[model samples]
Target: MTTRARNVISAAIVAGLLLPAAPALAQSDEQQRIRKLEAEVSALQRRVFPGGDGRYFEPEIGGTSQGTTVTAGTPSTTALTDILARLDAMEASLQTLTGQVEVNANTLQGLTTRMAALEQSGAAPTLASAPTPTPTPAASSPSQASTTTANNLTAMTGGASSQPARPAPAASGPSSQRLAAVQAIAKPKTDDAGDDEYSYGFRLWDAGYYPEAQQQLTLFVEQYPDHWRATYGRNLLGRAYLDDGKAREAAPWFLNNYQADRNAARSPDSLLYLAESMIALRDTDRACIALAEFGETYPAVAAGRLQSQYEANRAKVTCTN
Candidate 1:
């Protein structure tokens, strides 16, 4: 009637089957009983467990003194019956697993045999394998659509939220070359003279020359070691690497800023860039720590305002056992 009853019947039949003195007629009767028991177990398992994952289970306490009542389909009553059945005849677990493994092995053997036959027949030679697919990088950042969407998201979601400081765009491209040819790199300006090189970088960045900008920014740092713009130069180079989908490349540049001169005006921006780089690299441990440090180091700065956001993000991070 129920799953447990069927399991008990099967075990009883198995015991009877093992009896050496049992007669042939009695043995046939025992086999019929076992079949009947297995059928009952299957039915009860379907009704109680119902699905692959939602299997029946029994609590620590055994069934009622009056014998466990199966209230048709109540979760506790019927499910308990199913669970007790499964637990009682633990051999069923091994049988089920073995059946599945046997089926799979047979199928695989058949497939292998067929394949070998075909290859010998020369109907489908070289069917053993093909080259695996190599993954290319995902789409690069700084596309018009991507920029617009990111800007929109930043504006809308973070109106009340703190805006993380961003490094300037990449500044190495054809424009930088034009600027180099037209203007002195030393007297860089927006209006005239070295304006060409200065403007060239921005244009190259706008044209998506992220790798080029990374190189130019490195050069800029060398040329203007004492200038205030040197800080921004390194910052932009890091961003260029980020835009080019190179998180590791960007990380060191940002980290350099994090440890730059404490008295400098760009120190806050430097820390901000470092944190951003860490986040991009998915190095949450370091990123959160960096943000917390940012909060302490620049207590009143806008970049320091990112403390709450970083903590909130940290709340969602978890280490699995």
Candidate 2:
């Protein structure tokens, strides 16, 4: 009935009405935020999985999709193990293939070298017996002996007529002396027999006894396979054979020396001799190849100590380059 009581009652009634409607406004705002979030998630799914079949969350336990069930069992663990095993197997196979590739590359390189040799050998000359060494004067004709006697008589007269010239010494005298000198060389008996034997062989070869030189050098090489002088022995053996008119047999030895160790001291010598042997065998094509290889491989040696020999062999054959 009073104004103050009436105002208090009106304020209570207004508070009660606003308090009931506040919860409904809050609920409406919450629903709008959830819808906005759902729209944003849908847009993200479209960008991430254009196929439109992707799940935003993992499948529920024991749920089935594509006929395979998600479960608490060990199926996933087994699949992971299988994938790791496959990866390891693939790695091992890759290593094996890599090793095989290396082997193939080496084989290919060897084949290429052989092919090049074959190509160069296409027009090679046929092998022939090496020419024999020239005979000494003991086998001279009667006319030659008469000429020699006249030359001796003229030397004794000193350009004036003289009393009858004395008969010349027997031809056997010089031959016997040479034989005795060669026989006196004797095999080496010292501790450094390899060096001694090589020296012996060299002397024999220089003295024109190629068979004896070949024998000594062969023994030297066989007995001292690892000796430093082995390269020299091998090369000398080839030369002895070549000098003996056995070019067919000599060529392989020279080639072996060059191929065995290209860095050996006697390697260049062997190559030059190999070319010589090939030329002696009438295989001028291979001879040229060997000479070319010598120039390319040992330019310094080809231009130095072996220059004369190299040029002489090159002149025997016609090379393209």
Model number with the top TM-score: 2
For candidate 2, give the lDDT.
Answer: 0.65
Best by lDDT: 2
User: How would you encode candidate 2's per-residue C-alpha lDDT over 1-321 as one tens digit per residue?
Assistant: 999999999999999999989988997786667667655655664565354442332222332333333333234455467668989999999999999999999999997777545323211111122323332222124422344432432232124332112123345544777779889776555556667777678777767877677777787777886776777778878878878897866766676666566676677787788788778878766776677767877788778667877888898888887
Models 1 onward score TM values of: 0.36, 0.44
lDDT of candidates 1 onward, in order? 0.52, 0.65
| Alpha-carbon deviation at 295 in model 2, angstroms | 0.7
Task: Give the distance in Å from residue 7's predicted Cα in candidate 2 to where it truly belongs.
Answer: 99
- Candidate 1 has an lDDT of 0.52
